[model samples]
Target: MADFGEILRSIGEFGLFQKVILFALCFPNAILPFQFASVFFIQSDPERHCNTDWILRADPDLSTGEQLNLTLPREEDGSFSRCRMFVPVDWNISDIREHRLNETTGCRDRWVYTNSLYEATIVTDFDLVCDQANLLEVAQTVLMAGILIGCLLFGPFAESFGRKRAAQVPVVVMVIFTATTGLCPNFYLYLASQFMVGIGYGGYRLNGVILATEWIGVSRRALGACGTQLFGAVGQIILASMIYFVRDWRLAQLLTAAPLAVVVVYIWFVPESARWLLDRGRTEEAKQLITKVAAINKRPVSDSLLEKIVVKETEKKGGIIILIQSSVLRKYFFTIILAWFSLNITYYCLSFNVGNFGLNIFLTQAMFGLTELPAHILCIWLLEALGRQVSIMSTLLIGGLLCLLILAVPQGNAAAVTALATSGRFFANWAGSICNVYVQELFPTSVRQTASGLGSIASRAGGLLAPLLNMLAMYHSSIPTIVFGSLTLISGALCILLPETRRRELPDSTDEAEANR
Candidate 1:
């Protein structure tokens, strides 16, 4: 009797059938960037100042420019004060014209923004500047919190529900909430909507990857996994281009949400995992998909071949708790957990480093996104050439070492620092990209979604921490990089302890994984 890999080989592991699945799954992955990183555009704050309404009203004859120049104080850089103005006084033109106002007050009613590229933004709509500026970070943090929460929820849910159900539900939720986020009237409602998008995206994220992972055979699995991230990189670039035209945050939200809704209808075209089907004791359903896929791939096999395949029916259902109960699996799970956390921190740290590069923020961000595509292509080959464990360990090692190199370079040479940092980001992208493929190979199909979600929780945890950690540069320029580099180094050391799972049959349960070990 042949194993599943043998069966896959006979039926074409990466035929036209698998290619369709890859294309469909890549849609959601591309949309992933819009949820996680597009905030850089949506929340962009431009030149603004306290509302001149009181100043105009006080001196009825004062022209708009005259009122602003006379009433508001100038910042050290010669820009008008953004959050403050002189208390309106009865003083005549000469007193105000000479900038002689003694008492100053914060903006009483509202603020004004200069002509900007954006029609409006969350910052302008809700006045999220000054004291309110922190709320913007609050909204982003809430979304990350939702992502971490969703990571916890989806793992067990996907195991209990089928992968198809798991994949579609979040896409629907994401589409609805993401559209609603555009219509949000107030900041609080917008926060709620962003949090929901995060939840749905977090749930969709791992399950989609797992669904694609289960569909393809081992040799091409790394390729499929890395391809999703390439799509995400493309998504970022596409999103940037769209925002360049749309200019309004709400319209950008509506536009991006529409594509994911379209994908929801099309996700039905892809097949559920046969491995997941058999795990739930739906052997007939499993066999049906197998037959269909085999036919579609143009590789005909005898019914007797399908009948000869025997699967163990266990009473235990997979979940996070059950996964940790096995000691060997515990080692594997936690070590990968650290890798997930470290890679995420390192990746986001570089991603958010766009402003620090002494280049245009938008251009730097696009460069960062564009950098991931080739890195992912290289990473896929590295996973195949160097094998999983080696690829992950070496990439993390290289990324960490490069980040540390930034510590040695003199601070004034922006070009050298940026070049080294971009190089570091490239390697870190590969490290995170490979983890997408590597973690799935370690766990069995039963708890695969659960384990993947658990890993994502660690990743989101790192995401949540990165913004705060990056601020450590106020203490020392290298502090944040030093911390990020050290964590990846530690994670690399953890990677050294795991077993290699190259060109191996997919494990269906913890016992199966241990037995293979």
Candidate 2:
């Protein structure tokens, strides 16, 4: 039996079969938000009153409860039409007040509720005053934890079982929960469902990178890896449109979950990665898979093709200890982690707060989702043509600058600020997607998934802080925006300190990575 390295060398690395298999994984990234976006429905405070800061400043005599019916212009456009901004009319004020005292300050958290409120509507039978916001926070936070665990675990599975099985496993797990998340009855049940979803998310995210990079030639790996993100944006679009038609969160969750059943079909249509098969010491299997892929792609694989291939192996196995133990890799690790954290915190904060920006929640989310299409295309284009580090740094800087710009605009200029924030969201999303490719490339192949997972865990750590930022933004005015903006700038600056990975073969070992740095 050939060793895994010899087996991989026997089949030309980064071949057509890997690309097709990776693309199958990309499909889910384009549409898994059905359950993930359930947070929007689950924590909604329909009874939420419009922020009365402007009103309170103008008329100090109005009581908080008395201000519920106050008429306000919907936007800075100064339309003659007036809208009453409040949570759903059915909420019991007394219960809300009690929740405010115990859970939120001043009965606020309306903005935080916007992204996650949908989960409440679908999973829980509770009325308007339920403290679903906290539940959602828990869900979002724990999901990241699952993502952390998945990222750490998938590489071993992929190494032992082969990339196809490891990558496909997430699709199966996601299929199971994506179908069942809507059925969760209690808050805890929903939280568990999200954690499961996060595990799948982590698996898919990592698998997409590994498979795409491994399948494509080194020259095209960045493009192919980043292409997965375009699917994530597509997923956002599909989810946004689905939400428009399926107003009920449960149905929306079901609709999103149902599409993933196509993963089983992949077993028939998709071939196992030749490179991965080789890595696991299965030369014959790798050779067979490669031949079939080459045939399907109409590329002739000559008899000498296997003889010409070579995979040089080094004695390196990266674990948690090695990651923290190496100085250069450790710096890259921490920097990527902080960058991931900053990105997710602001990204989710902006996304979840769409409903609070004086528009229909679905409409706002749709606009945001649609914006990502162009954002991603622009990102993919610029990242390749320009250097990765420059693009990543510039994007983060632009995002942070836009957020700071929002503060200079007056309260009456909320529309301008909202529009600016939307632009910032676009930049941040682009930066984030690009960073996924960028961070993974910085590490050696042997520990690629491990390093990626560590960064992902860090990113999730930032995600865990997002709801808190949303909650803070609700109370501290421009503080949340300012803080997130500052974080982005700091991350961008740190990113500048990192080396570029453009047009370079992935480092095969830590020594290779440090030498390049």
For candidate 2, write residues 333-362 as lDDT tens digits.
888778877877788778767666765666
Q: Which number leads on TM-score?
A: 1
Prediction 2 global C-alpha lDDT: 0.67
Candidate 2 minimal-lDDT segment of 10 residues: 101-110
Query: Per-residue alpha-carbon lDDT of model 1 for 1-517, expressed as tens digits?
Result: 3456777777889998988898898778887777653356543456788886665545688777787877788889998888888888776667566756757798877788887657777778888887677676676677877788888888777888888888888888899998998999999999899989988888888788888878888779988899888898888777666666777888778877888989989987778888787778777787888889989999997777788666656547647777678888888889998988998888777765665666555666677678778999998887878888998898888888988998898877777788778878878778888788878878877677778888989998987777777767768878899999999888987898788887788886677787755
TM for every model, in the order presented, reads: 0.92, 0.78
CA lDDT of 178 in candidate 1? 88
Which parts of model 1 have CA positions greater than 4 angstroms off? 1-3, 36-38, 42-45, 75-79, 89-100, 115-117, 410-412, 474-477
